[model samples]
Target: MAKTTRFATLIILMALACGCAKRSLVALVPDPDGKSGSISVSNEAGSVAISTPYRATTIESAKQQPTAPENIGKKTLDRMFAEALSIQPARPLHFLLYFENNTTLTSDSVQLLPGIMAAIKERNSTDISIIGHTDTVGSKEYNSELSSNRASTVKKLLIEQGAEADAIRTTSHGKENLLIPTGDNVNEPRNRRVEVVVR
Candidate 1:
């Protein structure tokens, strides 16, 4: 049998036994949050794109062509990658803090800050992404600025709580990305928010 090794977000196969030979595999797996991601694997034979979990390509050797994509069972993966899985880093953490009509966080969202801080501090290593989003009630420029301000507000609070300033990244997606899609000029409380992902 072969074992798994981390390659970016994909899992790569490696020999795990004394007699395991040249065969190797590359599989795409979903994140712990159940969100799917994509990856591509190639060799001298050709290349294949894998976006679905469990889908993989088998490579016979460095010079030989890879086999067509196929499904690999979860049992097979667990057996092969036992050692690697044991040492993998904790999966990322996610939080969504909603805002009201303006950039100010809602009362409920403000209450979530302490829990968020605790999660970040519990990690051995942490990298944070704060993405701001706003409702489609204003001009594109205005909405963009509002989103950015939302993200900055969250970042400022995290920093004040002792989170490393350099470890946090902020982005604004204005009306482009929305939690609740609505027609123009709609006021959606859920659409106005900041999403923080800690990994």
Candidate 2:
């Protein structure tokens, strides 16, 4: 029985070692909107394409180059994939800040300021999205205005914390999309929030 178990483990280890020896193709393309893209890979006679909004696929597998009238060779494809990997940029990071009832001041939200600023500085973020949302406690118009104000407030704070003003874009969803859906005139604490996307 012990010999059988040892033999099975050896087979598994050999399989894993062989898998690691295979070559994989990876391509990083920027989306048309500059916010998303996709990656594709083929291994062991199978192929797959992965769609990504702000991140790159991390995988290691053998790749099959597409056949065309030009008849691109595997050597060329391998070189292209190598170059892409060498120059691929880092992926963007996301952060969320929840606001207090009818106010942009939340203890937890305030505490995130330093970390957000540090990430921006460390990653050298150039583009950022500051979107604000609110609960369904007031008229649509009023909520819209309040959400915009909240987003603006966060943007200001980010700038003061060393973020570039020109790189920040602020938008207000108002009460249109609630984190915790509720009926009209309802005050959902979780609904009042701001989302920050740093790229």
Candidate 3:
């Protein structure tokens, strides 16, 4: 079998040793958006795939197989991993702003800029990413430049709204990474977009 990393983005394995060695309790949890993804736990002793939210397994020893995942209550999770969960950082926030064409933001997106700015202020966000994308309606070189311009325009607007310039970064994907994929020379409004992430 191919080797795999046993890691979790939300909550990883929580071990409460009872004067025992190589024993652990692992739990799967929902992400900030209330969605849970699958994970696999394996070793030379055994392997198991777990996908259900709030499910847990007990590994008793290196030679013994991990117990089958069973549905567990949230209260149990809180009690068992209080300190670990409390220290977890708040989830990052994401915003998508659509464009009319080229570097111009649509009317709705223009209105959205202020709200994004407000969120940045409220979070006291120091890390920000602004990525630009364009529809596949032009040469790749032209679209690349257009996307770069779009990101720059958003950076300027955010700075005007009091966002710290040093905390923000910009990148352009041109028509290479489209929100709505399309054939060459096609116009896709959804593809003309700028995505912002505040952390």
Model 2: residues >4 Å from true position, as ranges? 1-80
Summarize candidate 1's per-residue lDDT along 66-171 as a digit string, tens digits: 6666676566677767999899988788999999888688999999998889988888435899999998998999999999999999999998988998899999
Pairs that collide, model 1: 45-65
Among all candidates shown, the one with the greatest TM-score: 3
Query: Candidate 2 lDDT, tens digit per residue, 1-199?
Result: 4543444354346556776664332434445357645555555656556564322222343444421112223343345468766776777878889888765569988999999998888878888999999999989999999999999999999888888999899999999988888999997878889889988
Q: Residue 141 in model 3: shift from native, Å?
A: 0.7
Best by lDDT: 3
Flag regions of model 1 displaced more than 4 Å.
Answer: 1-21, 25-79
| Per-residue lDDT over 1-199 for candidate 3, one digit per residue giving the tens place of the 0 to 100 score | 0111132211234342255665677889898888899988877789888998877777878788887787665666777789999898777889999988767899999999888988898889999999999999989999999999999999999999899999999999999998876899998999999999998
In candidate 3, residue 157 scores what lDDT?
Answer: 94
Native RMSD of candidate 2 (Å): 11.6
Count the clashes in each prediction. Answer: 1, 1, 0
Q: What is the lDDT of residue 147 in candidate 1?
A: 96
TM-score of each: 0.69, 0.61, 0.84
- How large is the C-alpha RMSD of every model relative to the true structure? 6.6, 11.6, 7.1
Candidate 1 Cα deviation (angstroms), residue 137: 0.6
Ranking by TM-score: 3, 1, 2
Question: Where does candidate 2 clash, by residue pair?
Answer: 24-61
Write down the lDDT of every candidate, Cα atoms only. 0.82, 0.71, 0.84
